[model samples]
Target: MSDFLIDEELLAAIDMGSNSFHLAIARLDHGEVKKVVSMSEKVQLAAGLDDNNNLTDVAQQRGLACLSRFVGRLSSVQANRLRIVATNALRQAKNGQDFIDKAAKILPKPIEIIAGREEARLIYLGVSHTMANGGRRLVIDIGGGSTEFIIGEQFEPIYTESLQMGCVAFTNKFFADGEINVKNFNKAVSAATKELLAIANVYKEEGWETVVGSSGTIKACRQIIINLGWSDEKQTITRTGVEKLKEKLLKYKHISELDFEGLKEDRRAVLPAGFAILYAIFNVMDIDRMMYSDGALREGVMYDLLGRFKHEDIRDRSVQALVGRYNIDIKQAERVVKTAQKLFDDVAESLKLTNEDSDLLRRAAYLHEIGLAISHGGYHRHGAYVLEHSDIPGFSQIDQNCLSHLVAHHRRKIKADLKNEVLKVGTPALVYLCLLLRLAVLLNHSRSDQMLPAIELTVLNEQQWCLTVSGDAKQWPLLVADLHDEQAQFKHWNIDLIIQSEKFID
Candidate 1:
């Protein structure tokens, strides 16, 4: 139950997809992931949405029930080792935070609702790792409320897009009457193709050597294709097979009469609409065949978690890219990060922090000065603005919010009125983190290579902390003055910041 007794090598990922919820538990073997167990449930969380994008009571119950089952299976896993991600449904929901709050009670970890582009990236990562290397591979993942299309080479993605078209949404919109007529099918296909038109030209120009598909819809498509003798026994869906299936689909005028050998009972209702979308994709994108991949978002999440543990963090790369784009001073960032980390280590144990917390602080330190590229006056607020609004890859909304909070308060007078807004979500952690970062920035006020005095941080209690500085009193008057000002900021967060100078003490 404790952090010390937990095994960091065992990782789990829960992908709360629109149509289904998938859980994958894996172990880190050398550098690769070896799957130990996998579980899935047809929660169809996306289909439970009402007109206003609020999940219905029935839908909430179904999702929670599925999660409860998953939680039982994850009894042995630690919270930090697990990553739970919600997709399109949660992203579109009006009262999403309400649902998240309820789910958090049963689940072992917090849920992260990833953006559409992020979903596309992770899908490509999942598909790319599962398939053999090709020059450029196009990955298509058709879910309940969204479909992600990505073009990538090896493990890196070049073009990523997520369309609003999905099986469940399309089915509800065009085929909810269950009339499998040519008219309805054409309408659905035309609508889906229209969405693709914007990306078609560019995607065709970029091109791909192979096409791959993931998720339940595509998997079911491949199964039906093989069962119908449209493809070889290998179970891969081909362009020719798709055409044959489309011809057969048109023959049935209604969903009730449509009984296919390979189609499962659960997939029957949505198959007609899903097929129309796929057929349109094949026609529009010139996809001849798409190899199916077993791995998708859940698998990618596991790999991403493993990367964090191994120090090959994508967030770090994202930070570097941000710095390069804004032309930030690398030396200044390094100076700040070095000082911030030293101060962080001094108070980490007393503050009851984790390595993840330390990493986030280091990243915040690196990016704290990014807005100086815009203007020097009130640049802390500007930096926070950029981090909060910009879509930095490999970071969730919550991650951005936390980073922005740190940058925003890095130098400002911590106001009491703003306390509830920032601390409401991050609570005591953000308060403590901001204080530590402020002290670090104050200590490095000169921004020079001159050695800093040996400083030790101690927490007398949750609301009281002392900084013991060992050096000559006259060495740094500016730093002492800055520290004195920082104390006022700490008082706003109810923390009494005390400074102790060894030379003056004895």
Candidate 2:
């Protein structure tokens, strides 16, 4: 069995945001998360993004420096128990891979760049966990490069959306000179309004009992209003308070000149842009008041990690939803899954595959035939498209892409180009998993529940492997022929796949 350990005593989550990087360390106590440590730094990674959407060297350096500090505190955390998630900046950066490679050297774990909707889901999760449980609530988080809005009840999010409007991004777009004039502020508001147009009607129609705001921008804004005495005793962000703040912002020609009691020096640069987005949200969605929530993406990730260890993985539900959506052949999927599990178990330790790898393989096996629902011809490609494009809540874009590659190449001719593509993300290990999946699918070609020969796999090295089946050679000529084809396929990837029967080896 593959050896992987989770630090049940402590869990850590890192949020590599566009504007800042935050780390939260916590321990689960009596079914509750007790935070032990927290750290944050304003890296402003998004502000360094160029016209081509590539992270500048300066931004990469800042991110690496911050993560290096975070690494120091993670010495005691288990690799499997910590999750580092990146938001819009990394998602938009063309040089994200280079940055990630640099960060890998300093971090205990690899960085996972989540999709927009997934970020929204996590933000909602964080907010829900911290806030009182009940009623449908609207949660908004304005990050450095993107903004996420979620509508959820208790611990479940009913709707989530992420828009390409954020403090740093909007500041760069409309307030680059640090000017806070009426015309520029109105322009920023208009830009933000346009971004919100797509979801305004739907959010308003669904309605929410409470309006909540998360992230630094919203928190800072709420504090500024409270300090200015614009808000009443409740410390709620009201529509009039926002208007008053906007009026004060309009009076200042430059952001540097605007000095409020609660606004910090670093936040002044992006305050106008953030406020414009908030103003647009209020106007478009008709929000009367919004309460700030201390929870956010980092907290959500910690809880999510906790859930995974608890065997309440949301990804499993996501996979099941995909299965039901496509009307897949359940029996065939089970057959492939059973065989995949057996093969995985036999060589997991020898191949150095982790439980995560096994889970990915099993999920892929279950959904491999989903594309067949679309068309008999090129069904693999169809399935890949669906998996890649669909909004799977718990899976990251990388996870979706990984599944897509496996599904696309499961049955077809294994092309060198495809292998290279999978290598870019999956590495050689994932290719091994894919090969295992292919063998399982091949073994279950009949798609019947009939008992098959016991099969075993042995991994001698990176590029060599063997499979042994417990049966007579003459009884399964078709299976023998398929194994020979698989052997040739593996040969293209420079892997020697040896097939053996009870008495003979081929």
lDDT (C-alpha) at residue 96 in model 1: 81
Question: Per-prediction TM-score, please?
Answer: 0.93, 0.96
lDDT of 1 by residue, 336-430 (tens): 88877877887788777878788788889888888898899999999999998886767776788889998998897879777777776576777
The residue-by-residue lDDT of candidate 2 on 1-506, one tens digit each, is 21322334778999999898999998777766778999999999999999999999988999899998998898777788899999999999998999998898888877889999999999998999998757999999999999999999998899999999999999999999887788888899999999999999999899899999999999999998998888867798999999999888788889889788878888889999999999999999999999999999999998887778777889998999888999998889989998999999988888888888888999999999888888999999999898889889889878888898888888878976677888988777789888989999999887777778778899878788989888776766778888898888898888999876655445
Error of 1 at 286 (Å): 1.5
Q: Give the range of the ten consecutive residues with the poorest summed lDDT in model 2.
A: 1-10
The TM-score leader among the candidates is: 2
What is candidate 1's CA lDDT for residue 416?
A: 79
Error of 2 at 336 (Å): 0.7
lDDT for model 1 comes to 0.84
| Pairs of colliding residues, candidate 1 | none
lDDT of 2 at 48: 90
